[model samples]
Target: MSHPVKLYVYDLSNGIAKQMSLQLTGRQIDGIWHTSIVVYGREIFYGQGLTETVPGRSHHGSPVQIVDLGTTDIDQDTFNEYLAEIKEHYTAEKYHLLDFNCNSFTNDCAGFLTGGSIPEYIKDLPTDFLSTPFGAALRPTIDAMFRRPTPGTTPAQVPTPTPVSTQPMPNPELVGSILQAVAAQAQRTGQPAASTPQATTSLTSPLHPCANSASFKSLLKTHRAVVACFSNVVTCPPCRVIAPIFEDLAHKKGLKSGGGAGAVFTKIDLATPSGQALGSEWGVRVMPTFMFFLDGHKIAEMKGADANELRTQIDLLLYQAYPPHKHTSLSLPAMQSLSLKPILFSQVPNLDAVANKLLSSITSVNNSERVKQIITGSVVPYLKSRSSTKALPTVLVAWTEVTSTLSSSLPPESLFPLVDMWRLALLDPAVATWCAANFSSSPLVTLSRVASKLSIQQCPRPYALTLLRLLSNAFSSNVLAPRFFIGNFRLEVIALVIPSLLHGDGSVRNSGASLAFNMAAFLQTGRAEAVRNSNGGGTVKSDMEDEEWEIEMVSAVVEAIDREKTSEDVVHRLVASIGCLLRLSPFYDTQVSSLLEVLQAKQILKAKLQPGQCGEKGVEKKEVRKLLEEVANKLCA
Candidate 1:
């Protein structure tokens, strides 16, 4: 059931939306009214930088035409969360009419909804107006009253900012009472009593917060190391802004969370009486202050909400308390005992013929960095064109010969030029597509296996990672998909390919994900090809056996998703693969079905992509959500 997302646009200039446009550029300007998103006939609106909520009659008194933004599979709660994140950033304090406004918010929501921006003309209205000389001259007059209008109330009645408490607070009695109350609560809650810090426990979480001087003393005594955050939750906005960041670093690091001997985190709210006393005791007046302590003595203090300074100071404390684990870096023993196996093929009838020709005539190495030229120079032109089936077999056989003749005494670096050339060939989509049809056979398997051998856990060599990624890239073309289920081929492919999903190297895991997507592409194209043939295309493609591809490849993809569950990149690719597989599956594979629920249960749905992560290639957040929704609705419903 698809829900059409309608944007209920209103021009704020009463009926002068056309006049406002005339004052600016010739863009289609919806009269300057506020806007809201109506989904399922519910008008969802935002105001004064608040989260999306059902609006009263004040907004959208007379709305413009409702835009049918296609449809979305996003549920209300998830959509609301996206709105909340927007509200957090586009707060009343931050909303600028010329910069960020309701239209900007609507544009963001529309982008999330349909993977398209709201009509460009509406989005550019403010900018269009501001750019003109007449509009520019009147901007100050117009901007003052319009940006953040209180829908139901006037500006005078808007909540006033709370003043920071500056009165000298040396309330020892109150501080002692607060400490006793916390201590009593801890006892009743069965929290660990104040005791000496133990190496095994990591002395509570670095984000374990304290409210007053007494709690701070208790934590300082118990943990022996502390990073106290002096923030104001009541009056200071930046203090509130930096509060979560202060805790997030601790949570991500987990040093103070019983992972190792790490620094303990404590919070002091200047708004409270004990907090006020503590602030005065520390000789601090400003909000969002940070002070580092060891053994109940302060060694460093930061006076502002500077993220860099906070991180640096916290890192300094963590370094002092819980130094880096010895095994974080690659060690000598792990490298010396590296046990790498080369991936192999099940059937190669013409191997000897190809190997004999390759062994007898080796291509000379060139000084240039162009790898495709080098490999092509070594082999025939048929391989590069990808027009003939004979090209794949010859290439595989030729590659296998190179690996077989190599001595164990030879260092992996000795084959750098050869690997570089291979990597380059795989870089080409034509070559990659042609190569993927070979599926789980010798050349691809051997290449991956050899790359795996070089991948020592916690000691990933750049070359090994690069080769694996290239092999993964090679499989990305559509040539392999239409032929994945011809006979016993799919099973053989899975047997050769699946273990790499669990490779300890994150880059290798990412590569395995790429390969899964490639296979998924094959699955989708294969299904479409089937539909095409069924619908009277005379191209009668061969035996796509029932339940075989789904049983083997779906299981392979599910296991791959499980193996790299922690990796968002891997999971993103795996989820896409599984979604395709489910559509392709005659009976939606149970393992794949359950996996979606597992991901949701584990909060993998809530997990955010890192900076610069805009999903895999062109697929963005909207697509990801749709894939998730398809699984959830079908399986759970």
Candidate 2:
């Protein structure tokens, strides 16, 4: 019965050793024997296919050479020769290497033979052997020298031998080869190939943020067409409500999709501050804007799309500009400006891509200088173009946010840009409406712009005049509670300008009057009293103090009412504003007394109409009678 003999040998040249074992297979041992006991002399041999020169048998092979440095009489001279032989073989047949010491070799051999024992020193070697030159070539040398028993060990316990590894161990060369194969496969598949590593992804690579315009531009080359939307009034609500729709449209499939051109949907408030920058760098202006990029170049421009309209326009632009290429398509083409695309609206689809393009282009400006240039040079003029209309109210909101952001936190010089933005907001009725609603909510914020907007009555009024119209509608619709105005003084400004309604330019004056009346009703709800009571004490006398302010407003409204006095065609808008105020004021009865007496003495009161006559005169009579009735009711109450 041949017992398993495990040998621990050392490679003197590389200063490491390993273990080998002979499993008891009832067959010739010659082939397996070579692997069991490695010869380390001027040559080190391990593995199969080697004839051993064992001693005395003419073959002279030491069936096993027990090289125990501690117990055996071999000194440094013998050790060095043994090491030299290992070197020769390793250099000639090097594969992968390992590191070890004597204690490590002993434990390894013991573990292999005993099945449960392993050497302490070799248990936790640093795995960085590949970092050294000898690491790759030293494995065989170490294995050959360490494959024999210690000098004093008894032969009874240690058999001559078989050498094989039953336990699993990592094979560095195999792993490395697998990695190279995988990388090659990845390359063939057109996927990003694995890097020089056999087994893991790299930690570093370029980051692509689809948020960037340049990135979007790159994507467009594949798609052939891209769409961008720009608007200034982006708040969380609009973004939540509206942005997703745009994204959905962008992602829609088989619309014979245009290759990816970078598309951006941004708010004007956040767009670049410079107009020239927006034009020269970002490529366009006039917001609530949209543009199409085809093959890396802007092919067309559009503006102000509600979701459906925007989709329609984009489809059209893409069809006209990018049409499906029967030929191979490349990335988007470089931008070309026939005369620089002009924005259609003041602000529509303001997105980050536009801002970035403009910002990057604002190099020559005097200061924090991006949006300022954009506002003054591009946006403002475009807005001023429709300053007399009532459609672009939201433009004001964007300008306000931009100016406010620039003025407060940006450099002192940033104020000039802000001033430019504020002026633009003031000039357009649409912009002013936006400012009045959003900015005027703050007294200090809206004072200057509100005052300026109100003072200006030029025709084709900033189409933003509709903002007031919208406010009027809100009043009539009562979405904004009548009682809401008590605490907000800014609404009073709207009231003060009320009588101006239907007076001066007739259309604006009438609109102004109606809005003022609505505001008065809002004031009449006594909301202000509650506010005053909360801030000051409650009392009807305190109400009188507020009356003083109301009186001044009343006087102004009266003047406007008189301006249109002779136009019997005029409406009774003044009556509504005044009547509501009278109901809310203690002095309403007292104040109208003199006017009532004068009308009575003039017999104007006697010019009565039959109960239901219907004409302009009848309407006038009815309003007069109603005003008298309200006065009588309040006075009597």
Candidate 1, residues 69-104, lDDT tens digits: the string is: 778787877776555544544444444444345665
* Model 1 clashing residue pairs (backbone): 10-33, 11-31, 11-32, 11-33, 12-32, 12-33, 17-31, 340-453, 481-522
Q: Which model scores highest in TM-score?
A: 1
Per lDDT, the best of the predicted structures is 1
TM-scores, all models, native as reference: 0.31, 0.27
* Candidate 2 lDDT over residue span 31-147, tens digit each: 111112222322222221112333213122233344322222334364444334333222212211222222222332232223233222222231223111122222222333223
Q: What are the lDDT figures for the candidates, one per model?
A: 0.48, 0.35
* Per-prediction tally of clashes: 9, 89
In model 2, where is the ten-residue run with the lowest total lDDT?
Answer: 200-209
Q: What does each candidate score in C-alpha RMSD? A: 27.0, 36.4
